[model samples]
Target: MMTAASSSGTAPFGLSVLDNALTGIGTSASEAYREVIALAQLADRRGFQRYWMSEHHAMPGASTSSPQMMLARLTGETQRIRLGAGGIMLPNHSPLLIAEQFGMLSALAPGRIDLGVGRAPGTDQATAAALRRRHDHDDRFPEQIGELVGFLEDDFPEGHPYRAVHAVPGPWQAEQNRVPHTEGLPELWTLGSSTYSAHLAARLGRPYAFALQFGRADVTSALRIYRDAFRPSPALAKPRVMVSVSVAAHDDPEEARRQTSSTAMAMLRMFQRKPYALLSPEEVAAYPATLDERRVLDMYMANTLHGTGSEVGVALERLHEQTSADEIMLVTGGHSREIQTSSVELVADHFGLPVGA
Candidate 1:
């Protein structure tokens, strides 16, 4: 039977930010990226623990297809806050390539870089197949992960097939005979919303971040599995849990509702395989909601934290306590850039996070 960590009164938790780089109704992809950069800078300055970007392909509303590429740009622009791939979707790329990419990032940002990896394709089946033939996949995600860590740590055994392969400009440079000692590696994290990834994380002894933003997962049960099964690895001595939640917060209750509604409609369209346009609140208003649409929207948003400052804060705090999370990762909706930014600030303030680095 699954068991949760007992929660005591006034449990403390760190707060972080996750962005999809969402495109507003009238905004260009470039604009979305600009917003993302600004948001990251703000999050960094505001003393948020980490600023992570998600990866999604073929989604017209999201601009973060390559989180490493985005991190390359972000590391130069922000300071202090950890910059990470809310996940890189490991199945999409080669382990050597990922190690090299993150090794380069760690070189650039050093201790501020985090590599949160996940197994999902982060896109539709057709787009996933387009990325590389589906048959080419090994379903050996765990093996790939081990290989990735090996490359990053330059730890393959002597005479092993991959022993000499190192993330170039990484810790080692292999010549005909010699290799240099290296100590560069990004903080690694395993991300998933299911018990499968939790089990892997526990076995591997890596930090785990649960993506509750869109997952139909029981956060408490997932956390229970992770904490109960954790074993110490070089990366971590104790299990660290981060619960990622969707939030649409505003001082104006109606404004928050409008933003939440727009996001719900956009999600509904995507689920129905229809146009996934993220409309403005006014545009969304023009379309009448059918009973079925409303029902689906309500069900989809059943776990979303929506309301004024105090209202959402209470729920977030409760969630943090219930999951016994080490941190809370907040992914705000694109009600608009202003609302999104403010929502982050609002939550930060609610949780009494340090302001202005």
Candidate 2:
């Protein structure tokens, strides 16, 4: 498969943000989502390339589980920036559903929709079973991807069962006065943390986004695999990559550490199957952490973007140099909304992204 040509429009580097919509210790889910919308709006104004949300299920700390619904909601409120799921867990739902959802979103927002798909279920086995209702669909991911893109473009080949199925609100024509987007369908990307996914995205020739935020895989090697294996497709002529990283940006290193503690703790707890709302900085400070607990936390947080804005900018620059990533999407949040918003503003400002719109 082929990919579209290089999409570097103007900027030397692309900056984006990922919001987990963490439920602060004292805040309710409703309030937390409201804060997520605010954060998305801020990123929109700050000129981030895309505002992507992660999908997590059955987690008390993370609220975003329905990326399609969130994309629809954010589309109306946001004016310019692209709104999308960081990577919708493809195995959790039917490709037709995803195609239809994103089709409607593309209709609603026109040029501001992105569809990044991942093979992970984004939840525990029990929760994944509940969502998928079956334990045998994981192997169908590649076929599902083809079905999804086929539905979106109405490009199914003859003898295909889904050939006659037209995704509702399929590609729309631009109004007479409003100029239309040449690439009418939502921008498609393959998201992953390993060379397997990178190779898949490369072979498919679509844009690739590497998830370094929670993944322990070798980012540099994964990206190199993507680029080295890429074959031109109708959708893309050159390989493009996006690398997402965990970020905790603040002026003081100690402050940064404190701010990121809640997230670090939450990650461990989630893995331990003991999810809880985000802890406050005070709670994290006073909580009794055993030596073993402290060691685990340290190991869990060993690879993160923790530093001031300028420092983070330098780190991202080095990453760009190392991976040749076209965009750097910062997955920042956990302790509080203020910290999340500030990190977004800081990264935007440091990157010299267009702001004040």
Candidate 3:
């Protein structure tokens, strides 16, 4: 029988700290930045392959509303871990700005930066309006992706130069510096909750990271589509698929539940309102698990691989065998930095990965 340790190929796993849990501790934005810095530092020392932040606007639960800025800061703070956005919501900003910001980050961090793009607006209609009023047609993500790709590749037409040439932190500097991005541009990935992203990743020949932490009921279907549709581009020799799983770990199961309760409740509330802060363990235990909470928990348990070291090892092993995913990206949401850090440590040790406290 195949044990958890030897069930799949030993591909490196990455740590994705998206929707990180620093907000509920009364940590201000600056403090949250520091906390993320700490997490990145720890992850780097832990031998995790990458540390990705995510983009969300007007959400009290997450601080990565500006992934570009956070990337720069994380670049300055950490040493080895590949740092980038788990995804930058493309509709929220201009592709040129995305290019510029990531271009600068690539220049600074050189080989250590990545820029994952997603098509979702990352917010509701009203908030989306607040971000880019009257420019409501930003759903043109496929077109926008082409524009961003063109800017990065410097493949824009060079006719009489009639167009205002929308290239920010243009390719000249990046090319000159010998930055090694995805396809010599930037290390890019596509984030999706459905088969759309999977098909896109396969078609584009870039790696795809599924946001299963907040995904719907079609995650397995999405992954199947991605793997089947994957086409090898010059950048990738074969298909690379990563699935995101929610994580909450401690030495004991009860302790793990205690640690995860607040975040669990927060996820429960998301069905009605936007994602918000981590709740207290006491508070989470006090609230009766509603039908919505139970439903969310069922969904979460189905998609997420959680527990202490041994249990998570088994779960991860089963996931690797089941999905054949190239990599597993864990979304650690907790109310305390200690729990957040501990979650990564548990996952690391179970995989025989070099771990740090």
Candidate 4:
């Protein structure tokens, strides 16, 4: 049930967006990039708090192989919304490089950049090996995170090996070069779907984003673990939790369900190790799915929030109440650009977000 405040055109929690820049079966990568830019501008103008892009590799369905590059593009297109990597897979790249890239982004849009780091590869084993050339880096995710933070903050111990290695365009570099910079460092957030990330984020006292859209872990347990073990640090004084949810909302409930079906079919294909490109709703309806595939689609749809705008709004309200999350980041589910943009507009209207000039 929605609370009085929520029903009265004010949400109980902050609303944000997580875009994967998905390319559908009939759509080109160029089209996907255009749609992402449009959607990000729309979110910025509609008062959404953040507009974050995901990082994926060797996936035709997702065009955001480098979320930092996409964020760089968004820095010029967007004005108010926070641009971020929803997140960067730390195992695939060097922390110093990530720090340099995001540090430049922070300089471009001071106080509006977020760097969310994750442990997952964001690709299959073969592609991961192609990217990292090593399989053991996943086990060193925590160490990588510390190194990244150290690079961004330039706080490695005096005896540390990287103490002499300053990330260019970073805080330390700016200070050392006597550059008069007003740019703030990118705000760091830890992304995860399990308690391992929750525990690590808590111990490090960074903001935790639990990706319920991708992971099967219980959101409540993960959030509770994070909060319970959280320690105050300079980055954060209290636990901050953001939950990402898959949603498809339309004026017509049936249309919303149809749009959701496309995403479910994509997930089914991904589970089968097939190409993960999204198919159109018409294609999804025509395809003959196997029994197991049908079961998987059913399970995905059951977990997804799909309905008319009001229905989705109510569901979001209930989720906010249940999790007590500080923010809700919507992973809009659909293949059509129109449907996805409409979904965002509808939700924004439901929450009565003040339209930007």
Best by lDDT: 4
Where's the lowest-lDDT run of ten residues in candidate 1? 1-10
Runs in model 2 deviating more than 4 A are: 1-11, 172-183, 290-292
* Native-to-model Cα distance after best TM-score fit, residue 143 in candidate 1, in Å: 1.0
* Model 1 accuracy (lDDT, Cα): 0.81
**Residue 113 in model 1: shift from native, Å?**
0.4
User: How big is the RMSD of model 2?
Assistant: 4.5
Q: Per-residue lDDT tens digits of candidate 4, residues 1-357? A: 122235555666888999999887888989988999999999999888899998998887889899998899999999988999989999889999999999899988999999999989898888988895467887888999999999998889989999999987877877888986578889899999998999999999999999988735688899999999999999999999899999988999999999888889888888888878788889999998888878988888877888988898899999988999889988986888777897888888788776667
Worst 10 residues of 2 by lDDT: 1-10
Candidate lDDT values, in order? 0.81, 0.80, 0.71, 0.87
lDDT of 3 by residue, 1-357 (tens): 111132254543443445343576455777677777887887787777778888777767677778777777778788877888878888777777888778778777877777889977666667888887346454577777777877776676657232445454656554566874432457878888877788888888888888767745477788888878889887786777777777777888777767666676666676668566667778777877778678785665445555676786677666666777777777877766677778777776776666544
Q: Candidate 1, residue 157: CA error in Å?
A: 2.3
Candidate 3: segments with Cα more than 4 A from true spot: 1-21, 133-139, 158-168, 174-184, 301-303, 355-357
**All models, RMSD in angstroms:** 4.0, 4.5, 3.9, 2.2
Measured by TM-score, the strongest candidate is 4
Per-model TM against the reference: 0.91, 0.91, 0.87, 0.96
Considering only N, C-alpha and C atoms within 3 Å, which residue pairs clash in candidate 2?
2-232, 2-233, 3-233, 3-235, 3-236, 3-237, 4-235, 4-236, 4-237, 5-237
Candidate 2 Cα deviation (angstroms), residue 178:
18
Candidate 1, residues 1-357: lDDT per residue as tens digits? Answer: 112121223437777888888886888988888888899988887778898988888887778889889999999999888999989988888999999898888878877889999988887778889988354453788988999998888889878899867787576753323764343578889999888988999999999999897737877777889999999998899999888998888889789888877777778888887656678888877887888988877865666788876777888878866887888888878548777888887776665555785
- How many clashing residue pairs are found in candidate 2? 10
